[model samples]
Each structure stands twice: as structure tokens, then as C-alpha cells.
Target: MLDIAEELNAWAAEGRDFAVATVVAVSGSAPRRPGAALAVDAVGTAVGSVSGGCVESAVYELCRQALADGRPVLERFDDDEDDDDEDGLGTGLTCGGAIDVLVLPVHAAGPVRPVLAAALAATASGGAVALARIVTGPPALLGGALLVHGDGTRHGGFGGHPELDDTVAAEAAAFLDAGRTGTVEVGGRGARCGSPVTVLIESAVPAPRMIVFGAVDFAAALVRVGKFLGFHVTVCDARPVFTTRARFPEADEVVVDWPHRYLERTATDARTVLCVLTHDPKFDVPLLRLALRLPVAYVGAMGSRRTHLDRLERLREAGVTERRLAGLRSPIGLDLGARTPEETALSIAAEIVAARRGGTGVPLTGAHTPIHHDGPLGVGSPA
Candidate 1:
């Protein structure tokens, strides 16, 4: 949802109205990721999104209804959602993906705001957070939400029974540190044995991380661009003299250390990005060698086609393979005809985004693969 819970809490705090649209599940090709969201405020204001366009207008209308009646909605958009043209947004999934959405009308709900605010803080600060929504019945089921921290303690609940709280707390603790979402079945506790508790657990880290090795001019520029693109940018160079706070002020931390050793200790998750900007072969060769060994999401080394080719041969002699070598975005960046440092930075950033999103940077009409891949739910997969 990308800070969406916070947005709803904010809207409620101001006495303004907002509706949360959630993608509960999907059965076919879905354009947006599962945690996709769209929030509409009292005055038709909106934040976040649910789909490409097929059902957003319907969602907005429902948001208005939610504001009017103070009600929560569970809406499912199925394969038959081919209706057209509402509120000038038009309709249809040109990408050919079916999606499901759940819209909940929001009120301050007292602790709902503070609990979710704590959640937002945990997410923004790189800590993990989880929430259990008693979708069916509860001591406070209908509008109740629980916030669990990464460490698995009772911080806040939907003002429910202590038994229900303890049961959900223990069951949900494992999910707190796991930055993925899932459905946990907590039906054996005191509240009711057969009734289920649906926990929506989301653990957000401090943006995707990118450590640029060797704080040269390109390193400085890459740090700025990386931060703009929501990376926890770090600038590292072994030579303390070249690595300075003044050269890379945009960087979150300027470290003077051998790049390979630092990443080996800190990098985790496929979301981490590593950029080796030192053109010097002594540093670049080893940096590239180390990056190839990690499971990071993206790794790019700054150098020319010739320089990259030569480095690859050296890597091959040192026993690195073609599969790993293919992962490197050499002569890094897009085909943006970038000539200067700033332009090159933009191109590199664009390429990274494209790779992250699985986009080919080509026109949709000319592409053969479906615009939308099978989302987490595998909406189109045959059962």
C-alpha cells in the first residue's frame, strides 16, 4: 500500500473523510501488485491506486458512498467487469488482468489512527510491522485492528478480549519480521475456535538500499539520483582522502572502506542495489567480482563496453560464469544517448527502474509478452 494506511489515518485525524481500496485477491493476469491501494478523500480527493483503470471509477463512487453512510465495503471485480465509461476515466484493462478490490470507509476509530501511525513509523524507519484484521467477528471485530511490532509484543489491539489479543499476538509475531504478506489462521483461541482472524502483515524497510562503491564524480551523482529514486544511498571508497562528506552530501552515509567487505556484511533481500563506480581496475574488478556473488536485485558497474569486456575476461579467468556476468548492467544505463554526468545518471536510473518492473523499455504495441505478469495470486492460473 506504500504509506497508504498513514494517508487514511491522516485524513481521519483532520476530520476529513477517506476510503481505502484494497486488492484482496485476483484470479487472472493482474496489472498491479497485490498490496496495491487507492484512497479517496471526502472531497473526491485521492491517493494510491487499485488497477490500471477498469474499476477505479466504481471504487471512487463507492468511496463517496462510504463517506455518506460511514460504512466499509468489500468489492470483488471479476472477469465480467467489462462495463465502460464512468466519470470520464473510461474502463477496460488494456493489459488484460482481472483484479479484486475491497473498499473500507474510514473513521478516526480512536486507536486505529495511533496504532496505524506507529505502524507507519515502523515501516518508514526500516523496522517491521504487522496488523491483524478480525474480518469476521470479535470482541471488537467490525472496525477493530491490531498493531504488532517486529519484536512480538502487545502494543495495541482493536479493544478486544485479552484472550483474542494474546492468541493473535503470538500467532502474528512471526509475520512481523517477514516483509511479506499472508493469511494466518488463528481460530483455535478463546474468541471462537472456528472463526478465523485475517492478519495483514506488512514490514517495510527504509526504502530499497543502494551502496555506490568508490566516491568519484559519478559516485556523487549516482548517490543523488539513487536517493531521489527512494534508495538508502551509501557512498563508499577505501581511500579516505577521496571519500569525503563534502563530495557526496546527498549520500546517507559516506564510508571509507573496501566496498566488497561492507556489502558482504549488510546486504540482504533482492531489493538491494549495488553500483560500482570506480573505473580503476583494481577496485572495479574486485567490486564487480563481489557483486556477482551476492543475491542483490541490481548490480551495475560503470565502465565502457571495452572496459567491461576486459573485466569480464578477467572474471572468467578467475572462474565467474556467463549467467552471473549477464546480470551486470555494463556500460550501465539505458540507451538514452546520455553525454554528461547528470544525463548518464538519469539513464542509469531509468534502466534500473525498467529492470525492477520487468519492462523492456519498448512500446506496448511492439511487445509480445503480456503487459501484466501473473501476480502473487496467479489470478489466471487454472485451478
Candidate 2:
């Protein structure tokens, strides 16, 4: 699946035949969302996971069986252990949820192999692509796939009626535009007639942006953490000497322009997170003033308690509204008694993830909150 595209792409390039089991639907408290996959190669080597660990062994065997028979299969695993008699695999998820997985073999001569390979290559290269496959349909149409690109181009087909392909492509394009991965139902023979078919649209978009504004040591550690979180990180500081590739090697880009100036021209979306580490009034005021007003996921600034108060006054004097300032995460990062740069970066990254996933900055051991919050499921998720 697109989640493990890089590793799967490498396997495909090496001419290794494999079978992949991808989660197409999920319900209740499933640990993994849709588009999560587990793949096993001809040599029984495995990569990636569908459930965190609950049903991996069963999914692994399912992949091996798929490779052996060259037939696509759709199986459901749930928390009902008593239902083992229904399926011979007898695997039950203990996560108090259910998932539907589609297993398909990717042999060199398989009709769907090339399309899968193309999708893996595009996704690994950071190109926007969507793979739409039939999760439930007629016998011949099951597991058939179509690859849709960002530019509205498409390759492969479901081998269904022409209208069915057109309808699925259009729906897949719409999902790709929103960077959404889920299911869309359509009639079998085009939009007009026949049995209903469910197509799973898995989208692979470029990672969201994490712009760290400052070139201090904390920024270096934050860059590494941001990259670890699958963000295309950018480090921007007006001081060219401090902003260098050597200092923040993990950052995708190092900008020498003023923080506000660079952000003014950069492409950002609701998913982008802005971290302002420059505590100087000049840089902090201008940057925070702009960042707080932007439609970004997070806007955090690093400063001391005294410095935070002073910066707040300066921003208020700069005409920033109280509502806008309310969004600012001054004195950035959760409280963990952080002393070192790495520890501070961890705190900051934890806060950012907490904000994005709607988590409280509190210990979970004694808390009654759900481990996974009901937050927005980003691209490639079936929420």
C-alpha cells in the first residue's frame, strides 16, 4: 500500500514477487486505518503491518496464500473470537474493532502488477497519486485497479463496462483532490445499472510541511523530529550563517530569508505546522503575527515566561486580535522539565502531534480518555 510505498517500491524494482494485504475498511476502534498494508515476498520476507500487532500473523499467511493461488481475496477480522468457525484462518483482532483486508498477488506477469508498480514508484518519489481498486464486485472485477494521477491522468482499469471505469475515475479524482482515502460506491455497469460495487481509493500526497523558523540548536533537533514524523521540513532564518544544510541536514530546505517573508510566499495548507523559535521581538512579532493568523494546523513559538508576556504585549500593540493570539502556543512545547535540545525538541514535537490528533497534554496511564482521539483522518486513511 502507499503507506509502505518506499519499501514496496524497492522490492518491485528488485523483481521480487510478493502478495500484499491492504486494509480497505475499518470500523469501531481498529488500531490501523484504511490503506494500511502488510506484504510478504516469495521468500517469506514481510514488510509493514496492517493491525498494530493483533492480526499480523494471520494477514501474513493470507498474503502467502494469495501468492500461491494468484487470486485476490477479501477477508474480515474482528474481535469476535467465537466466530472463528466462519473462516478457516481463525484469526480475530483483539482491538475491539473490525477491518476488511484485500489480498492480491503481484507477480511479474500479473495484469495488475505493472499498475501497482507504477503507483509505488510515483508514491515513493513524492508524486501525488491515487490507486482505486475494487474491494467488492463481480468475480472478474475484484482486485482490479486503476491508477489516477494529480493531473487527472489515469492508467489501467477495472475491466468493467466503460462507464464504470469513468465513474470510478471521476470519483477517485475527487478523492485525490481532497487527499482522501476511503470507499465510494457505484453501480457495476457504469452509473446506470447492475450490482453495487465498493471501490477503495488510496491516495498518496506529499508529506505536510513543518516550517521551523530559527537556526538555533533546538531547531536542528526539531528538524530531525519533524522529518521522523513524515513532514517535509523547512528551516527559515534571516541569518544565512546560522541557516545551513550542515546544521539541519534532515530539513528538506534551508531558507535564508526573513521568516515572515519566506512564509508569505510559501505554499501552506491547513495541515502545515509553523514553529517560531526566534524569540527576538523583531522576528517573533512579525513571524508570530503572520503565523497566528494563518490557517495552519499549529503555530507555536519558543520563549521564556517573561519573554512570552513581553511578546504578547508587543503583538497586541501590533494590532493582532485577542482571538488570533489565542491560537498562539507561546512558551512552546509541553512541560517535561526539558533541559537539553533533544528533550526540548521531543516536547515540542509531542505537543504538535497532540494538537493535530486532539490529545490532551496529560498522562494517559490514569486518564479515561480514548487512546486514539476522534481527530481528522488525513490522506490515505479510511475514517
Candidate 3:
């Protein structure tokens, strides 16, 4: 969706008329999840994809028709023919995958321009907003969604369902706060035609934060790698001399505050990543203390074997429990025998990716430990 929104912004900036096609529901095999999008410019150039290639061309044609006819439409596709797995949708999927898609004519939400503008603004700043589009079975959620947390208060929404408005708004707020994309159950029970409705909660989070708490050369390399990976890199150190903007031009911010104090200020899981390259007890001891307390997605420490052991002892003495200490990825990065600082950054980034994805590729259901060690273990997810 972010990609589509970006392309839309570019198109609108350059004065191109376009429509956005989205996969609103699925009954069986699905190539992409719900809320997947594909932007269709008037002349048939498309960006992003809702289905592999199974339905993109078809969806684009429908978008053109909607643009001409001036009314949103629902379409379906069934590639149940003899198309090999590699030929078309990339699934080589000749077997069978049916899908339900909606082609919405994206004429700015009215005052459509400002409404669309507000949604884009939230996305630009990495804020959260829900787009409640009514596609299947009625004129209920036709207008748009009440985009919360942006330039304006209430944006667009389903016409005339005050109860639904309240319920969906509450769910939308919860999804935005968590920085997640999900579908909530609501609307369709009351007198409004009773169609089981699905509202997609799309989060417009700023680029992820990558905070390196040391000003070493490793920190510089990590900042470069983090930027390549789309993180809003920040290199921080208490030493003004070591931490300079020249070292990391890619970094969104650089602070001369103490490592521990900075963690206290901004250390939530969604917006923060603490990379302790300082490797100094004076630096890492306090930094690690504050990092473990928060629900950060990744907290990695770069150090030698001896340094790792010593740091663990300090954390233990600081009254950090074994369970919490277990989460501390000392000697961070995968066991890829990374020798150089660059290789080490790749290895660490790989582990961080796996952690965020919540798996080590090891089968949790087959193993004896807890599913996540935290979240739900992906039941039949590919290895």
C-alpha cells in the first residue's frame, strides 16, 4: 500500500490520472494478503500488484472501465486453466486460485482532495490511518474512512452507520497505535443489509528507527547498512566529537545525549532499534539495562567473547532476570563467522530480520519450547 501511495503521489504530482485496484477478500488460496494494492494509471501502466500477475491486467482493464463509467466495481478472476506455474502469476499456479477484487476509482475523497491529502500526509510522516472502503454488497461504507491522527480529525466513512462508525473507529485507533495491518470484524449485523464487512487498518509508520549507541567505525558501517535496509538511522553518542553528522549523513537524527537516557526517551518496540557498538561497560551496561525494559524489536551488542561474558555478568548484577537476559543478543548477529565490520553488520541485520519475523527457521511446533518464545508460532509456514 505504501508503494502504491508513493506512486500515486508521484503520478498526481506530475498530473497523471489513475485508479487504484485492491484485493478486498479471499476465500481460498491467496497470493497476497488482504489490502494488497495495484495502481492503474489511465493508459494501463501499473505499479505494485494485488495478485501475482494472475489478475493485474484484468484488474487494470476494469479500472479503465470504472474511470470511464464513473462507478466502483467488484471483479473476480479464476486462473483454473492450464497455465504452468512459471508462465503467469509467478505461482506457476495452474492448479487453482480464485480471488475477489475491487476496483475503486480513486478520485480524491471529497473534499476528496484534502481527504486523500490527509491520508498521504499521515503516510509521509509515518503516522496511522484507516481507509474504510465499502466494496462488497452496498452503498454503506461508500465514501471512505475517518482517518484519525493526521492534519484533520474525521475524514471519510461509511454513510449513515453511526454504530459502525463508532466501532470501526475504535478498532482503527487500536490498529494505528500498534503500527500493524489487520482486518477487524464489524458491520453487517444491524439493519444495514447485514453484509459481513472487512475494514483494513493500514498503518503509516515513519521509516523504522535504527539507533546505534556507539560512535565507532562499526557504528558508521551499521548506519550505512541500516539506511540501505530502509531504517531511519540515528547514530548517537555522548561524545560530541565522535558523533558528527558527517559520519552518518543517512541518519535521520544524531544526538549527544547519554545512551541510557536516550533509550528512556524513545525505546518502544515499534520506533526503536538499539545497536550497542560502544562495547564499553560504561556505555553498554546502562544502555542494555534500559533497552531490555522496553519492548524493542531488536537490541544487539557488538563485542568480543570476553566482553560478552563480562557484560552478561554486569546485567545480572544489575538485577536483570535470566529471562530478560536471555533476550539480550550479546555478540550480536548470526553465527556466520563474520570477520569484517561490514560482514558483521549483514549478519546482525539478518538476525534482526529473523527476530522481527519471529522465527529462527527452526520448527517451533516440532520443538518443545514455546511457540514465539513470544508470539504465535507460524503453524505451517514454509521453512
Relative to the true structure, how large is the alpha-carbon lDDT of every model?
0.68, 0.89, 0.68
Write candidate 1's Cα lDDT for 1-383 as tens digits.
43465565556557765666767555667666655778887778888777767667778787788767876666666545444555455455544556656566665663455565566556545565666555444444654567777666556775646777787776567654434454455663445467765544444434667788887887777788888877888888899999999888888999988877776677555677777778778887777787887877788888889998888898888778899899888878888888888888888887777777666766668678656543321211011
Candidate 2, pairs of clashing residues:
none
Q: How does each model score on TM-score?
A: 0.74, 0.92, 0.81
Who wins the TM-score comparison?
2
Off-target runs (Cα >4 Å) in candidate 3 are 13-16, 25-32, 51-55, 75-100, 108-114, 139-143, 150-152, 189-193, 361-383
Q: Candidate 2: what lDDT?
A: 0.89
Residue 124, candidate 3: Cα error in Å is 2.3
* Predicted candidate 3 versus true structure: per-residue lDDT over 229-262, tens digit per residue: 7787878899999889987776788889899988
Q: What is the lDDT, from 0 to 100, of the residue 365 in candidate 2?
A: 96
C-alpha lDDT of candidate 3 relative to the true structure: 0.68
Compared with the true structure, model 2 gives a TM-score of: 0.92
Model 2 lDDT tens row, 212-259: 999999999999888888888999999988989988888899999988
